[model samples]
Target: MGRKHTPFTSLSRRKRRAKTLHIKNLIYRERDRLGGIFFDECDQVAALASGRWTWSDIIFLSQDPAIFWNAEIITANVAFADAVEDIAFNEAFSKLNAAETQQEMHLDFTPDVSSNGKRWLRKPALKYPQFDGLTFNDFIDKRALEIARDNPPAIYCGYRILPGYASGIGLQIVVEADRLNRAVIETAIADFRARGERNWISDVPARVCYSDKTICTPLKIKE
Candidate 1:
């Protein structure tokens, strides 16, 4: 025989349903917040890729602790680093080939005359490969190259959190795929909140890289 339904049982069921709905709503809210952060990070990467800013400019902007703590932001930071490295590598490859031929690459800079005509205002040259019809600076910034070479931006592998506040936490924020889905959103939200709650303190901000094995250190922000 089946058991009879009771008012108490109905009430308990309603409460369970209500609690589940609340948690679902909370997850959705967190997802939206994380989605926003992810897009903002992508925008920063786009700006750098489009030549709106230099590697130095991006590095300087990323130094803020607020930017570094989040998983989404770290993922974007890794993307930006990869983009810069690719750019530098391509430029070097092209130059090496061009150098072998000993082709004289012309400087594309057009000197603008000063108001008094006493001096010329030289605009910063674009750091890109020379094209057949286009021109580029003949000289390369050795210092910039050195910085890029030595401190190749690390990939966001994973993170580590110790028991005490003094030990601090290490996070390697990485998003393997380009596409964002529910799982990615949930993970991002969790990591972000975890880092925030921990309040990791340090003299220098932790440097994240693409590789899991790399020893996290502070990046040299200044060029």
Candidate 2:
């Protein structure tokens, strides 16, 4: 009698290992990306203030999806930090029973613009957004809890195979896929070029990175 064949193949094992490694790298890569963007933007903003770079340059750089999303997270963090201090001061005032003056603290954690991609912090809002009757820290703490739940340590690696194309226009696409087909890739590229053509009057090149083997390239797919 023929020996029983195992279900798991050697190829499957290699793919599994590759995916695991990819995810681990993504965790580190994402952190570095966020940090790099923050520091880089800090420098850029300083340059703009100092007249070393014009507003046009800063605006151009902000067009990149990666930079834009990172900036949003950084902005949210800064806003949250500033709010904490004010909250603490107000809490101290409230504790002093001298006067029952109602104090109002408003926090708008929403981003000015959507990054069209996943960032370290997305959809940041106060857990108790309304701040009905809670202390400053209490409201802030609740928001922190919500943020922790929404933005976990894990990284999503579903869209790495696509290009890094970006248009100065608001429209953008950033996604990851485990396996991409020819039609999907072509469609994405076509859409990307179309957006560039529509918004970017000048000829600007689009970028593509096929980090995963499962992603089909135009050449390979045609073959």
RMSD in order of candidates: 19.7, 22.0
Model 2 agreement with the true structure over 1-223: per-residue lDDT tens digits: 9865432122244553454344334334433432221112223333334432211111112222222211111112223333444544554445534322232243334444566543334333223223666654565455544443454222221111112223111222332322222233334335544454232221322222211112111111110
lDDT of 2 at 53: 25
Please name the candidate that would achieve the greatest TM-score relative to the true structure. Answer: 1
Mark the regions of model 2 whose C-alpha exceeds 4 Å error after superposition: 1-57, 61-102, 106-134, 150-194, 197-223
Q: Judge candidate 2 against the unseen true structure and give its global Cα lDDT, from 0 to 1.
A: 0.31
- Candidate 1 wrong stretches, greater than 4 Å: 1-111, 117-120, 123-156, 160-170, 179-183, 189-223
**Candidate models: Cα lDDT each:** 0.37, 0.31
Q: Which model scores highest in lDDT?
A: 1
